[model samples]
Target: MTTTSPLRSEDRGNASVTRLSPFQPLTDEQQRLVDSIVRFCERHSHDGHAALVMEGDAGTGKSLVLNTAFQRIQSEARDRDSTRSLHGMRNILLVNHPEMIKLYRNIAATIPTLRKKDYERPTSFINAMHKSEQRVDIVFIDEAHLLLTRTDPYNHFRQSNQLEEILKLARIVVLVFDPRQTLKFKGYWDDAHLRTLLAGIPTETISLTEQFRVEANPDVMTWIRALCDGHLLPLPAKQHFDFRIYDDAARMYDDICQRNDACGQSRILATYDFPYTLNGEDHFVQTGSFHLRWDRNQPTHPLPWAERPESIDEVGSVYTVQGFDLNYAGVILGPSMSYDKVTDRVVFHPDRYEDRAAFSGGGRITDTPRAQCQVMANALFVILTRARQGLYIKAVDPALNERLMLLWKERG
Candidate 1:
């Protein structure tokens, strides 16, 4: 049986575009990578090379590095007009998310040097590669883990994985990926698998070690990792990190609203416990006293989920907020996640989890209950790490709430 396409097309009717602020200055590691790419492009103007893979976790500034390199290369191309040999060098940045592609195009429109044509969705770029005879000099793929394999519905025309097709279209391909961020069945890229695919080709790997997001607090990030790994324990107190556990979901929602009013970048997110309405209508996620709908409409360009006014009252799922960040995050742990008093651990119910697409086919190595639990755990881990300055959480299960409260009290 053939699977249907997972990409949902939305109607974005003439939405007014907003200009985003300029990117932050790159860290030392990010700058070095950018410089190396620039030098490689200049040195290999005639002969093409293989691919370069950069592995980094969510908050390691991979996006920053790619954007900086893009801008720098465009500026250099314009300045080297006298050097006719380098004038024809072409490059493009491919992102897997549609909303992100629209967001980047709107941002690129404001800058005089940046071209909107340089940004595209991965599927569109792949189609273009098949149609055109010309090969792009370099292709930078963000969120490379989201690239689909041959089993995906979107890969109907191609017989091979996305990485192979991408390598055929460009001399130098740069991929920024993290295995833990793979949230769908079709996302088949991992470090070990990618290395094996590029065995004969020249490949260079770089790992980013510094934490640039989540308020740059290593202790808070450590605690988050532990929590995802099933360690239901209290975190050590830190001076700058803001972590709080709330008994009431309504109160947590109110706090998120207030944080957005004060700081401008806060959002409420929840697990895939509630099924989205089938008739294209919004469905409310009612947990305790708190009630809100999932983001019904696609957000307009320029202002993304964390920045849009409509998103303030709507709850985001893992798909919408995976590759984004916010100033503060209010996370609701729904019925799918619960506390097992007998085992003294956090447990996941696969039946209660609504994201059936994640486990529909036998894509996972072992499609057992334990594997499903790990997938859900990773989803929560992604949502928890989205906040830069603060994190607020509400557990719907009373037993889980009491256990968290006791842990918090012990830390005090």
Candidate 2:
């Protein structure tokens, strides 16, 4: 639907959303930022080659802010239009956004797509928009952190397939991303040239600092900061965060079941880095056990069980659990195996280290975890914030926890 309209809300009086948020209202700061950016968009009024890079910590209302702004833009456009022509002018083309797997994948070179969900077709939805004369006034990239440079080692497809052309089109491109979530791949912000190229266009940056995720747990924030910066916080353990590092995940799972079962809701996230034949795509990664339940007295975990659903019962990874939350969350960090900090680079956690010697024959593929710690820390911070009431973290690797503690110690 190419309709320009503001997000309708019944509770404008509410300051910040808190109670089991399905729809989170923007914070005052976020709203102000959106107003300024939207004002700029209204003022500049360009038809081609313009963009806004929206980056922030997760839970800081990046998506909410953009959605609110887009709605406001629609309202403003409508207010100005006596002929309802501005609605057509305000046509927005959201490019290559990440969301529910089915809806996104179905939007292909041909719509109403058919195939197994494991399709590898559209990367940057921008290129498709650019080719169409459909008049997209603004282009918003939801997970812009997933944006890859023309030089990343994807190895499967052509580089010129996406991003560039769309950047060349559109009145304004709003990029909402957090590079911390980019543990598995390289994104648009990773490369300097791409940044420079995007910067070459008229751009302004708006950063969100107030975090709405991970409530009442400052330690989670501290650990995140320490991980991101080598202990660059006032106090890493400012408050108490219950996310613990357990030696045994199964035991933790049992404990979680027992405790949460009493309240009749227990969810488990079995982060098993295992080799499985689920349609035969090797998921080669380390896994662990994570459990979160409403109460702590349940006898056992439930089914539909492994993956999270909007029903608020079972739990899974970012894939299923995203857009939903719980009273208490326990994210089991399998291993601090994704990064290192000693050599000032992004290296895979030694535990999850895949031998790339046969391919690169060197350390080019694996960077020093230290180098990537800043990004990783940011990511961990975002993940930690996902909890509303309490957070329980259980890292399998003691050394990783120690490193985290060290980061806290250094923060002093």
Candidate 3:
């Protein structure tokens, strides 16, 4: 007997509800940004090449703005009578993250005007366009910071820089980038390099500053910023937001499960200090008595790691949780981090880090101890910013745990 697969709508609706919907309404700021991007694309559609960059931290809805603008561009490109006057122009959207690419493809299935083929990974898009000897009218890139600056033969990308290759194949390019969320040496990016790339071209930048994800006061935001900046400051009083420092990892998992039950989209996350691999083996993140496997590789699975029901029992990493929003996140600061009593700051030990793939083939980017520290700190920064309503944390280092617990107590 043979079985048939479900319709795309039925499959997506039953499996996952993503945050990257093209139909989601935009705020006034988002709307203005979209209008500006559309205008830029219109001016460049017939001739000339230019770039527009949207800069913001996590949870500022960068993806939302990009998706909305892409939909408008697609509509105008397909409709000759449309007032925007972008008719029969080719366009596509690219994202470096596999999980985010899956989410965007699932979202495209639901929208009538959007096609799954319209979305792709940057590497694949570059190679395919090269083979066809074709140039697109417009290209949209989400999480541009994750684009590879150096070639990786393992990933089948032979080009030196992804952004440069993309610029040569598209008339207009729009990117959403946050340098602080950059996690790997291969994808290292900063303001200087990006500006140098756009030096000769007509470029426009939009900076989004409002915090739209974490439902917290300014003090709480400041505390998180300070912690990621390597400072061990006093915890702030958080009345509206649920912030907690747990003495035990097991206790934090229990509470995260409760949050997942009470409300959907809550999970536990960790830095790259744990042992994990992609060789089809189950590697667990162990802290105290709390042991859960890291997120598995599900190539055939349509749903993202966080959207899967079984993933509640798994611990997410920076790769799985980046560009995703959770109701509550329980973060375990693993062995790579320690509290320095002499300097009164949080220090990162690169030798203790276990994510070997991140540092593999790294050059000047990971040469200095300070640079290695920043890479790990950025991983923690991504983990810390995933929570939308609440944040819970547990540190594996005893001194770090004690410092955080004492700060929590003093905040009360």
Candidate 4:
């Protein structure tokens, strides 16, 4: 069933280069929280202050809040009188993903006050902290859960942890974090660990309950969360949100392509069940009759999978799809996941899991099988919530597929 590779080098340059539109209007809850955060920044513009942590799950407007707050703070700094004490304060947005940096930089280029350099990676921000004589006034970190610990190879300067170094870099630190989004073994930050790090400092923590993604349906989010936690099965329901179970992989892929053609943003995602090699060879994901290559390694571009047209034929993994959103997401449950008819629940097969690095190196971090399975579950949950409008799912296990079909019948 292997076919010719659909991704070509020529298709890379044909990607659309339209400027990012203005951010969606903030909800009333988001606006209220933003106002409070801005007030805190204004009061502690000069002094070294405690960090403010914003916690939320997938689809919550954490990115929206951080982006809006960064722009508002920059405007306030520019408009302040030169004689005022808070004038000329420097602020920067810190993130770990290179694609996210490029994405935000491209968006910032459209605004007059914002600069591309304002968005940076963790290592770059830490290096800048050592050179600059003046402390950064405000630092906003998106995806704070991805912060590396001392075990990370990127910690060349031997910093204790990312949180410690970031606190030293800025007086007013703002972190947007979700513990469930941590995909790698090196990502060590959590609620307990963060609280321990900020023991001596005064901190304010806020929780976001509203979900802006997945068609803004709370029921869908609840079901996804329950499924990830192994509290419920993958049952179908006739809810307001769009969710479907497909018996054929090819049909699911075809539907994803059609959605992309009509909506301009859609892709197929799969679990890391196939061996991933770094040698740049094409490895196809073959399930039953459906066969397609995994996403290619594009060295030059920021986010080739989402930006390029040919990427529509490639299947994206968690590493490529994380920290990004899509109009529709078609998820393929590979060999790693299965349904236990005896227990009547979903189970993860660790031996079949391909991302060995995520399980290795951290001897005590994820020792038990259940712990490793939880990480895999987290990866699945992240993929499921990437879609803003709809979700199409296909399971490879026969028992799982049959159960899904039965659930759909029950929904009627």
Candidate 5:
């Protein structure tokens, strides 16, 4: 199951520090933000404090930042309460934001002590917390981007929502999120909703804007930032990227793979839409770009594979790789990001693009006009930055991939 995911040892009990170095030391702004966040946690480590938001661009080191800060927070919390059901808040469960309350429910279901249908909505959530007495010092949301807004049809229950329930239960809550990586309004994302959830507390929020992923100068990085920021007009309002286009994905991949064998590890990618569309055949994952594959298609599998599997490790969606990282990542922009010049606009098959979306129009935007650009930017952010030194992009559409070709051509 090593598919698109990073190597996960069966017992992930052993913490793995990021081997990658910082692109640049945290900017004064980032340091100030981290200082404030760290101090807030220090004060609240004993338990009970206002909520905090860890805001940043995707792959800007927010995870690393939060993780490092959390270690200190846990250490401080333990100093205060030795018997708090956690050696260092071991009772605390860091859940993804989108599936916030639902995640709590799912974990509760597994425990025999907790009742599955005990209650619904926030009431259910609070009741469960009360039953478990998860009165720890803090509650953390790891992938806060998944946290949805109220407009989502999939999420009907308000009180049971992740944000709402966390407010109700935890003495202190720390949520790390990048609106850039946010999915959709499964919940509500309006200012009104934000105020209601985080309204009162003086939010010690900061945006991590520096990119440690792509090794580029300010000029080139600016273009990448513009694309992701949705400042690039007519591009679905997302942080776009600069890349090298390839008419032949397979040939380019073969060359990269060969080069990788010569130097070090390298990867090949393709969208589910044309999984193996590289040489012109559906040889990769049966699923296209949208469908995330963790370890092949098999659900139950080993964690850190003794030996890397065959094609399973070769192709996967961006989602599967989220959390996990690698030495080098190569991306093939499938037909998904293809903009038909004839149509004069990009056309994305809803089923292909990644689910994450940036906030743009005042309403819910599907995977077509808005979803593709934002998700692709995020994917690019992750893929490019994962490699310590290099990033390779092979976009199929001659038109779309050409934007990337400029970087290479200019280099020459």
Candidate 6:
């Protein structure tokens, strides 16, 4: 159960933030996508406001493809003897997640050509572009769903839409988007919205369907996806993967610690049902004898929350582990999620959900109750997919716990 993923990047232990190196070995499909991206960039380097939308589910190697293509495009830009298609281009990479920003910046440190400054948050990149009145050749945005769609003065993002602003500044904008990963109301996005944004603008969409993170088989993946979509199906048997349900959260934490000791990058994750704040105080997530605190916001911290060894005692939320890979993940489905016997489906309780920021739309998102429920479901989907080798779950709701245990027993 402590087995780490065999495909984990060799450099992960060193950086503790990255799942793959920029030049890490790529599968044939990944390489082809990277090549196509480079060609797209080259062809549209001088074109006006063109976009390449790369859409995929969680763990589809979207970030890897973006990084590899970026490196190649930067190489082409620097090569004097080449066609100079991207020569002297000013390209930047944007990600709204702080943990992802840390990962990419760490990855940039090892490469002489890739500057850490080139990797930035979308808000920062957009603000800098406006202040300088500068236009870039290509802009690569990872986790584009996290981009703010409406003006948020708190984040200093005054734009109505992030992608629209980036398109205005860059000739070719490449974005990696997953609608399922959109967690906050401020950054809400979907295919229709994306199409509307790119209405008159030239664009191409590429979808990646392969599952690259989990070691589980197709049946296991289907079960997980179904559960995330609010349907609780019969739990499937594991194949080449470890999946289990724990009645005692304390026991689950013990196993996660053991996995972390045996292999690195193992941690416990939970839904945002518990109350927490950034007022420099401790908030513990208690379940029976299991006691842990939520991952703190450490803006100056170098390593990601899950990467820090001390984080084993802390519970991570979707924000911390979304783009990172874990050797093993012990997930706590909080009280906000429950199993309804009448419907035989997983139900979300917006009143019980504690992530207030995710619900505060400031008039950007309508249907407040449904939007809050979707936020909870989206958080579950993200935490459920973080595990590479194994997934262990401990449900807080009594009815849900009972139902999950019954389903686990059926996994014969």
Off by over 4 Å in 2: 1-24, 75-87, 93-124, 130-135, 150-157, 186-188, 191-194, 217-219, 228-247, 254-272, 276-315, 318-326, 335-382, 398-412
Quickly count the clashes in candidate 3: 0
lDDT digits (tens) for residues 133-238 of candidate 6 = 9988899999998888888899898879998888888888899988888898888888899999889988988877788888888887798889988898887676
Cα lDDT tens digits for candidate 4, 1-412: 2333354332223122232222557789888878877877776665667688999878777877888878877766677555554468888989887666767787788777788888888877887788775578889999898787655654554565787888877888989988898776666445788888888877888877787766745667777787777555445456655688888888888777777777766888899898788687988887877888898877567554666667788888887777777878899988888888888787788899999877754555645576678778889998988888888888887887788777767766
The whole-model lDDT of each prediction reads 0.73, 0.46, 0.84, 0.76, 0.48, 0.84
Clashes of 4: 0
lDDT tens readout by residue for model 1, 288-385: 66778886656445655644666777888887777677778999888888888988888788899888887654455555576677778778888998
lDDT of 2 by residue, 208-267 (tens): 888665665555666555544534233335454345444554555555444344432234
Question: After aligning candidate 2 to the native by TM-score, how far in Å is the CA of 155 from where it should be?
Answer: 11
The parts of candidate 3 lying over 4 Å away from their true place are 1-18
TM-score of every candidate: 0.88, 0.64, 0.94, 0.90, 0.64, 0.95
Residue ranges of candidate 1 with Cα displaced over 4 Å: 1-23, 80-86, 154-158, 299-302, 364-371
Better of 3 and 4 by TM-score: 3
Off by over 4 Å in 4: 1-23, 80-86, 131-134, 154-157, 234-236, 302-304, 364-367
Which residue pairs show collisions in model 3? none
Please give the lDDT score for candidate 5. 0.48
Looking at candidate 5, what is the lDDT of residue 22? 19
Give the Cα error of residue 181 in candidate 5, in Å. Answer: 1.0
lDDT of 5 by residue, 140-223 (tens): 566655554443333343443567666767766777765544444443233345566777665666667776555445544554
Q: Report model 2's TM-score to 2 decimal places.
A: 0.64
Which portions of model 6 show Cα errors greater than 4 Å? 1-12, 15-18, 362-364
For all candidates, what are the clash counts? Answer: 0, 36, 0, 0, 26, 0
